[model samples]
Target chain A: MTSAPPATPVPAGVRATARIRATADGRGGTALPLLTGEGPLALRRTRGEGAEAGVMLVGAMSAPLGGDHLAVEADVGAGARLALATAAATLALPGRGGAPARYDVRLTLEGDAALRWLPEPLVSVRGSDLRVRTRAELAPGARLLLREEQVLGRAGEPGGLLRSRLTVTRAGRPLLDQELACGPGAPAGWDGPAGLAGHRSLGQLLVVDPAFEKAPAAAAVLGEFAAVTPLAGPAVLVTALAPDALRLRELLDAARRTYGW
Target chain B: MASSLAALLVLADGRFPAGGHAHSGGAEAACAAGRIHDAATLAEFCRGRLHTAGLVAAGLAAAAALGLDPAELDAAADARTPSPALRTAGRRLGRQLMRAARATWPAPELDALAAAFPRGAHQPVVLGLTARAAGLGPLDAAHVAAYESVGGPATATVRLLGLDPFEASGVLARLAPELDAVAAEAAAAARRARTEGTEALPAASSPLLEIAAEIHADWPVRLFAS
Candidate 1:
């Protein structure tokens, strides 16, 4: 019996790029002069109330397979307000390449502008590896509300390797910078008491506003596994852990309501 | 070398009066929630804390000990800490540590750090500077920090849960090898930061610890301050 030929390594997955630029129309309404989507990242303009402009992220195809490079950029002009959301949760899937997938998100807010980035959860499926990095630059008067949720795996399956980093800066000074690693290949004891503490899902909500500079948020616990605390800068952070995605979202929603978001 | 080693021991000692005894390093909250009910769970808690928060703190301390700018490291520490409660506790502990460090080993750099942050810097940053002032190297600083990260929580668990003292000590004893490895990794990261900048430092975080710390801070009646 002859052994089959060794499998050939596939080339890198798709390199997708998407961008959105929102500006105020000077009459309290927002204008989206730039909306570009490529590969798996699709941007669609949806109706929004008040002076805010809504943009929904629609996945055009299955993407972020191993070795894929994806990037999304959003720029909110002065006095503009932009609210961005995802149509559905993102699934990280395994591919032929041994390399991990990469997703980079860059958000910029000009003076007096505001942005709300409420994307759906990113699920780490078994055998997949993904690295996500998010960077936000805010002007002094700008405000930002961002949310991130991660589910370890689907159903009873164990999750793959997942690493995420978040960095936020205001006027070129660091406000918040943190990284989290989960699943296989992460440091040992990550699921133990001091880490995720046996939780399968985790989420965080970041709220930055000029008003917070005047009166910082008072620290409080929103649930059994969730709490809200103010940052040294003009921001408030809510962090939570749950057994499932549904419970994680519920905790975050409760925190948002408590903060009047 | 012998005096420096003594300094390392003094710095790592719980009786050093750094006010670390007042903080449980999230063990109090975990204890209250029944997550750390005994020696085994306490060991699990310490193991997790050792790898995540402990590693991060050790990296910062190592960087500081390498003679990096205290102000920059303090800002980096602030960036890495998302929970305001933990940040506040760190600064208070930093202040207490700074006072002890200055009295024990007077140095111009320590004076400058205190002047720059009158309120207090982050505890890990102060610890690194203290190690520097004591003629210790980055590795020594990392070792001190890595041990402190779990030591405080381990000691606190004994008080909070009334666990066996010998078991608590055994948990720490069993973790000695891991502490050594974490310190080495942290020191290497600090060495990388010399050329790569503070961004090279470890940013690993434990989400549950941050959340629990915030909750613990608001507890009307709690044994530990954080």
Candidate 2:
């Protein structure tokens, strides 16, 4: 029988280390701070009157549940760059206004990774923007499943919004860099004809599943959402527009079900 | 004033070709879905979007063009766009316009702006860069910026709805007085720079058009990229 690893206790005065593990929604996430030659990450968090500035060097990870948070600040050291960022990621924000509230985040994924970081949408209005700037250097036979999403506003409230930006580069070249800001007023922002198409929330699933990549025959199944365009490379994007965050999540999950993530 | 008029003419020239054909300004997909059917409705849609997305983008561009510091303008516009696709398209359009403007007329600031926003800058930023490059004053730049932005999509509707060119020009001609009025306000905005909280718009609601634009990403075949 496998025993679950214990949760690392939060240390005082902006510091903590070792292999970090966290969970939310019954799913556990782990982030290894020391990247091969990258060395140890540093996190600095300063709490003030109404705001807090936290920066992570080499950085760290956070539990996806709203009740838990991992904040830090640190300048990163340079090293050999890779392609995909495969660190298990789970983030969350618990409303603390005593009534209800919302959060917005901009997460950047930079540095070395496997192929290109294309996460399925994992947005929520306890909001988080998982911005990533990654340089992918894959060694072949490596698998990647990137789920990205924006959950708008508080579920109980009639109005809520979330915005996110993510960028992935490979071999010092841009592969996929996207900034998504979706909320209640989003549909009306463009006076656009296809403006949000009447949906308050959205999710996208990016799959580099070996089966889909190797077969090449699955082209027909994948061709519907992706094409050879000068922008965004030929990666399939299965997205859903819905009024509720859960509904959008459901749609994205269903789409990825076929990929076997 | 003559400089302003010339600036307006230059900026409003749809034929100038800044890759304008690639984007419908949200009109193509909207019209395809039957959300924006006619001129009045389109105008209504424009006013609403101008207040939210359009106003934010233009405001940022105007602020930058007026010499308020490019970094501030970038942040202001970045704060306003809550939609990733729209922002991305805005940057693409801005880049295309910068490339086209530079090829036709080389301006140092325009070149700098192109460098600053290598990946993408909003449309207004490109206009301000070009206007400044053309030696147009801030007010002059503002007039050109507001008018061209409106004109580009208006022209699209003409082809989309079979509205005659003369008829379309007539509508625009009729809109000249209103344009002048709007241009005056935009010129004022160019003087100091605007924050994300402030916006200029004619009040109207077009929920359908906005929704259509959001859902356009799902469409199987798209004529215009944006």
Candidate 3:
């Protein structure tokens, strides 16, 4: 089995697209029958460990400075399993001529499918404007575990503006619909005690599955920084904000491991 | 003419008793954190809320005022509010606001909505319908929503931080122009929402506010409900 992939930097303004799909193998298992993509996006597949199906490495050559567009789509067939991860953080540089960079992601999960998407943090440099939207559609009995983190600025610097929206639905019913805007002049009161209370880094992890509630140890593993909010449906959202990126990373990693992924 | 404009005043009034006094709109939590220690920062904080959640609320209210289906708007409200705690707070306030609106205007649609979500719909949904029952237009409803978005927080700060009442009032007055601009945009968006569906409404959200509201809800000792 190969180790984790290394970081690569892709140029700005290029649109990258990747698509992966799971298929039923003859041995009562699933395989990545459709794995292909283009542009700055790269995907590396490795053998699965434990009860996993496979692991895919998602990487880019350079930071999406400004005006860059990246689109990623993944599908898990019934009873399949896949874990998607990134090699390094993506920096949101200042917009070239005030055009906000864009990142869009879509995921589809079939019956009894499971996926884990743990992307690296996005560092928003000063004067940068970025827009990111993610949509997830899940069929009955499907499961998804995802995490997202953002740092307003580099160490000793103020952060840029980032507007992100995340929408998840299960069997055509809305499970979670969240929109977050941060950085300079954003609506959220980052300095407020009720808000970030002066935290510069924010992280969120979401778990969508019927089995989520059955596991009683999940909340205990979240620790102090992260707070888990279980919804009325089969979804739970855990959020945390920290004074620095390191703390946020530690908290989210702990949460990531809590799910046993 | 006097009564029509007075209706707007009555709904926008801070003392109208719509259960808004209990919510700092996340301001109490902000103040407790020392993010808003003075008048200047308080103004800035209110400005952020006005443009983001305020604008979104105004848009939803305007759509409701335009006579759109209350149930659809309620669902839209649910979609916009990602925080479970904030959603519960919004619904509670909505119920209180609904009781006040029904008593003040006595409209059948408002009665229908009250029956639909006995627990309560989102506050903006009820606020917009309440404006319609009061003979106000979409723009008027937007103004009420936009102003209250900040108004609740400003007043809450006066109590939480103990800032000068006069100074807080001044902060609101200073925000008049921006508030007007936001209300106008909300009204225009509501006009589009008529044909484009509720998706046309603004979804601007404050991550910190939503997160803080959730955290504050867990606090065993807090002054505000949200």
Candidate 4:
């Protein structure tokens, strides 16, 4: 009888990694040559528009609990296009470990490549602590459209500790680097007048296009709580705050339509 | 390090001709939107600004005073600031402050900064370089930045809402301890950044301030420039 291999023991908290690599096919379409997922991070290929490869993030189990370490990396080669989305909102919950969970996302785009990262909002539940960091590196002539949203808490909860940082570099130069801290243990007055101003939901949409180098986006307020501004580089950033997640997505969607993206 | 305390006073003075008086630090917009009216709301606004924007500005100033590259620090400041209107305002104020610094304390670094930027660098960068030129330490620069973060808005609130001057000043006075703590934290961050890199500096953000500043810039009739 053939002996079955011993099952690997899973760690206490989840340690997951998801990787994706997209390359351009000869016929002007994109193909994912590599797609890997481990532990709770599951990656599924989905149908995308012409010339673009779409990947949907599917959670295989309840993960990213306190003390969990999750990482996702995506690389788009030259002339390739990729779209990434999430199946549902990620909920950060307290675990037995009581340590802060960490989620890191790294993206790389080669020459003339494009990436659209549209993930669902991350909800910080009560008594949970989560830190998320996203870094994107783009080569010359590359384009990126990234959207991130955070819902402070669920319906009647005050939420837990959440810290998020986004850093983007193009051609090895700094484009945008910002960090937002909310919920418990953040700086004082985070929800005060100059911070969220009593708003619960916050999000940002970043668009980096080489074409913006010529005709940059004009600085304008998109709504009462949303404003669009051009960065120092050839990019535009839209920041918005709302009372809830649905309204926050509406604001960002409206901004997406404004740019026809 | 022994330095001229009077120089710190002069640089931190609200009456100094650095064009800060023309900017409300988003207080004007808050008042217009009714987010800040009485002294209580004003205090809350100032505290929020102090912790987020104030902390970031103080770190940059402290790093610059420690003799970090002004060009790199300016770029870092640009990366931190996501608003074009705020960027313009910062440069404009930097230009104005550069003129004042050149007259007050002449330094080759300041001259090089002015020549390199031509238009101007970010104000906190210029402020830190000015503090260096004045023979001040990084903590001094951090203190000046922390003070100015709340001072501008406090002064503007007095004018915008017609709040009691004593109350406005009291609000600032009550924030003295927090200001000192922020300045200390900023100076420490700057020290770490000096060795580790500019990424070590704080990047705390105030979204409402940024959003309101964008809307304020488009105001046809506004008392303040930002």
Candidate 5:
């Protein structure tokens, strides 16, 4: 009989991997889950009331200074539902050789599955170079709600550098594929009228559910600070930038509460 | 060298009448937001954009000049431009550039792109294909893309901030060396892309520029389209 490999210590600075799967219970609901990982990567699932029941946090596998490589692969089976969140703000610090830290997330949603990735802000302190790439594939009727917030640096301090790329697809067509690269000189253009218009913090939220209506209203209300762009599918991309992280957080949280996705 | 370089000059010329005059590359918004107050800040802004968006666009143009697939390059451009407003402006610029290039150069690939996009493709993709039609190489395409990346904004700033046109020109001149380096790197990447695929192209981005472009789009009255 085949068996899972025994756990081993993951060296520092090495990539820690996590895979979580949520399958249909078949009796009429989604199953609990099957999760595996070691090191800085870890997963915590919570059984709350109704929609909050499937919320989970996939975070760093181990404790390290910085420059930890972590991968999270999440699969939500048909008719399954999962709301994913980050345990805390990811603090990116200076690496050993000045190399940036990295995080890679891959999510696949089967037919009729839903995943809400509402992670907290990823704060990049001075001298911190961080890169995050998130790729998601959705079945014909699957749904995904994802958000990414970046704080250039701590309050009153300049941010280091951050490069983030997000690619989302349904069936074989591209719904939304976006990349953002910012660094030490971020405030120059971003703080300008043509760029973030002087905003330091930026937030990107993408929703692919057909039934999600609160976005349109919320987007319309946010006006200048936020702009909503509709995709080919029922999806919509809302991007917002603020002068500080607190304002950006408030803008995003307001949308989150209003949309309730 | 003179003939090919001259053809590139014409394409990169601000007065080429390709609708480039309508867009400021987010400079108008930046100026109004007080991000660019003088020649020094303007230079800094241009330099910042040069390495990020300029580099990315130059790489794509070079790749396109190398005869990479238009659809694939278009998708790459789309992936790089997160702001929907910027995407629309890019295609609009592409359509305008297409009209001029078809009239001036006349290439089968350009025709194919016009047919496929009907609406339009991304600006960098069209720029590369236009360079091919103009008998220019990848380096020339990269130079054109890199130059336009700052040229448009510099001119727009001149008009928006009323900064001295000569000073703005000076900023562009100061950025020339870096622009050359970016174009060279873009050309190198394009050559590599011939074998390594479009993923070899740079995806450097400016999130502030992107987010600002979206906000600028919603302005009830704005001088530039994006």
Candidate 6:
């Protein structure tokens, strides 16, 4: 994959929308963002309707596998009402890549806005080491819903080192966070027989709803081996585990079936 | 006027019903695997975690206490926490803290923030808000931060070490001075603009902790979430 010169940080006002919905090709990638960053992929929320808007990062060009950091400032407008959803990012990666590439997604929710994130699937290529970092905030009564997923390899293909770290916090506090560095022959956390029973691609979904958490329904929506937990009266936490990539997608579809319009 | 002592009493209560008991502070697994042993080693572990995850996370909560943008605080803490299990642990604790704090303090804004960040926020942020709701100042908020970040594991060590529970409580009590000192220093440092990154909260960093946490993630019979 060819790399573009570092991505120049544009001024906050009226930055053009960057929306690339790329898919994974056998050799490397397709339609990924062909660009460079002064340092890494950074998106700062200059301003927007607290709950009505959010910046989307689409990968049109897949760059060399290394460490990539994506920083974001997400503001969930206060008491904005309607349940906004954030799509869980779905990335397709090959395992053969040398070093692990780290991806960090940071969020800040203010006012009374709500957000829900759901993505397709995150596939790690053979021998490739991958890492992901995510941080999100939930302001007062701002409903935040999210699902994180990862696959060892593409359907029927080889998979390798796919390490990752995810941290989620509200009001600068920690609700859910973890770091994993796993490779072939290593036990994937929460995938052992006793953990989640060897699920390959898994997800940890966080839901903030003042009314009913309804964890049972959330798991059914994901359609995989998942555990759901209730927290803080206005919060819901779901841990979904799958045996492979396809199964993980099935679960995401299930979640949409249960909670989405 | 809600006294700081009242807030502390509620926040630090072992049976306050925040589900703090379900967690093993990574100490249980680490100890079971021989990663930590005895009080000296436990002290070492707590100190390391204080700077990395604890300080950084609690710092964000302190920002929230200062009325800094909650979103910024959440993002910074998110950037700091990298583990999925630990991430899950943070959100769970944060959620419960918000729930219990709301019951005691009952602020509309607190309820709103709790709803917005249900699963991903950390414990310090909740403490910051509850401290405010409980009529606590910056110093009191900082104390809550230090205790939530370290006290969980210190208590866990008591069970793991088979040490007297009273001694474990004493160890935590001894930390009061340190907690007070750090909270004071952090409050002093937080007197800055919202744009400035506040790194003085509470955090703990240890590669072994990371490795142990990762290993624990794969355990089917693991005791704690992190």
lDDT of 4 by residue, A21-56 (tens): 999997899999999999889999999999999999
Q: Write the per-residue lDDT of candidate 3 for residues B105-203, one digit (tens) a residue.
A: 999999999999999999999999999999999889999999998888889888988889999999999999988988999999999989988767787
For residue B100, model 1's alpha carbon misses the true position, in angstroms, by 1.1
- For the second chain, the TM-scores of the candidates in order are 0.98, 0.81, 0.97, 0.99, 0.97, 0.86
| Candidate 6 residue-wise lDDT, A133-191, digit = tens | 66676655556677667666666765666555555555655554454444473322222
Kindly give the stretch of ten consecutive residues in candidate 1 chain A with the minimal lDDT sum: A252-261
In CAPRI terms, model 3 is classed as acceptable
Q: Among these predicted structures, which one has the highest TM-score? A: 4
DockQ of 5: 0.35
By summed lDDT, the worst window of 10 consecutive residues in model 4 chain A runs over A7-16
Q: Residue pairs in steric clash, candidate 4?
A: none
What lDDT score belongs to each candidate, Candidate 1 first? 0.90, 0.46, 0.80, 0.92, 0.78, 0.55
lDDT of 6 by residue, B32-94 (tens): 755457665566555545434454555666677777666656655554454445656777888
In candidate 4, residue A229 scores what lDDT?
89
TM-score per prediction, in order, is: 0.93, 0.49, 0.88, 0.95, 0.86, 0.47
Arranged by DockQ with the best first, the candidates are 1, 4, 3, 5, 2, 6
Report fnat in order of the candidates: 0.82, 0.12, 0.32, 0.76, 0.27, 0.00
Native A-B contact fraction in model 1: 0.82
TM-score of chain A of each: 0.95, 0.44, 0.85, 0.94, 0.84, 0.63
| Candidate 4 lDDT for residue A114 | 95
Displacement of residue B151 (Cα, Å) in model 6 is 1.7
Q: Which candidate leads the pack in DockQ?
A: 1
Please give the interface root mean square deviation for model 4, in Å: 0.8
lDDT of 1 by residue, A165-230 (tens): 998989987888888998998887788888887788999999999998888888777777887878
Q: Please give the lDDT score at residue B91 for candidate 4.
A: 95
- Model 5, A1-261: lDDT tens digits are 589788764444766777888887776656656787767666777674453336456555322235677778889988887877777877777766555678888999999898888887888788777778888999888888888898887888877777777877778555666656676743234343334445668997777875643443322426556766555456767678788878887877777665547
